[model samples]
Target: MGQEFQGGVGQVAEGDINNYGININLPDKPEFRGLVTAQRKELHELRAKCEELGDDPRDVWRRVHAQLGVCSISEITAEQFHEARTVISGRLEQLQEEADKRRLMGKILRSTAEKDARQEMLNFCDLSFGRTQLSHLKRNELQRVLEFVQQVEINPQPAAEIPQVQTAEPLQLREFLLMYKTNAAGLFLFGIFVGRFWS
Candidate 1:
């Protein structure tokens, strides 16, 4: 029946482009063609966005690699590419949200501290994660950084002025030697002992 033909997925003309102007290799297979064409357009857009944001496309591939267990994006199938696009989009969204959170956290810090709060947050994040910038942090790491900033802002701790008390343990030979180099009393005692015994 014509209803049977109409009930299933439709077919496209051979050698035609999708709505996005991307060429489709399998026109008779509309579902596959549409999915692949859309994926291609998305990937193209993703690359452009990465260029605009000064992000490496390798980061996207890294996410894809983690999911597919493939080494590179080229090894991914069209369906896999579509899935990767979703994953990449989620990451991009998370990065934007993290930036906004950082901006808000900076504002809070600025209100409480007299110094450059934004710079302070940046420095803290850099030191905490061993990364150059907040943007380099992964999604979970970004959340952790946000929590850290909030905690610090909530209970802003001034620099500790009190020196830490040394543990109640006997200093070893290497420790004593280091102490002798730094402490004038230790150095003088060492000199006296050497003069009396070695000379």
Candidate 2:
């Protein structure tokens, strides 16, 4: 028999009148830990997906919009979440493998600082910018180039002869921005602090 109360409807609580409307086991979920871990994993997976897409996956996930909605487990079924996770994870793995191959190709560019990496970086810049013919790129790609050059330790120099390549570690974003003001598109991508629509 179903419990009833002052509420004139089905499945109401004894003292208060909150209708469950559905059967929930009320399992030992360890709510905060379980939900938080799931949320973190989902977010991490989404970050990987965004990298594979070469653009923000938040737009695709409708995650920002959904956050506004405050969707519940009931609102978004677990199956949907599972499907999304699978697709994103698969793409992330594929992209990571391809990136490793590209990294190998990148190694050749690194071995000759002044000789090769500059031409390769310039070629990437051109291919990357394509029809726009613009030196500037989306801030993310600009950072990517800066990171690549730094990793390769490609230096600009007026040398008497082809200088020996020396691999310097990647520079911090601030240092790159300061050093390559002319080359860098001048912005940090993928970040926020104190969300607001500023005037």
Best candidate, TM-score-wise? 1
The residue-by-residue lDDT of candidate 1 on 1-199, one tens digit each, is 1222233334544454235444445545334322356676777687667545556777766876798777865566765766777777777775676666666555445543643356656676777788746556665666665555556544357887899888889879788877777685777888999999876
Q: In candidate 1, which residue pairs clash?
A: none
Model 2: ten consecutive residues of lowest lDDT:
186-195
Q: Per-prediction TM-score, please?
A: 0.35, 0.28
State in Å the error of residue 161, model 2: 18
* Deviation (Å) of 138 in candidate 2: 26
Q: How accurate is candidate 2 locally (lDDT)?
A: 0.54
1-199: candidate 2 lDDT, tens digit per residue: 5544553343334564444576455456542322345754785667666666564665545553254343433344443555545555655665565565455445534543545666666766677766322233544465566566556654557668867899999999889988988666533221232234342
Off by over 4 Å in 1: 1-38, 47-55, 113-199
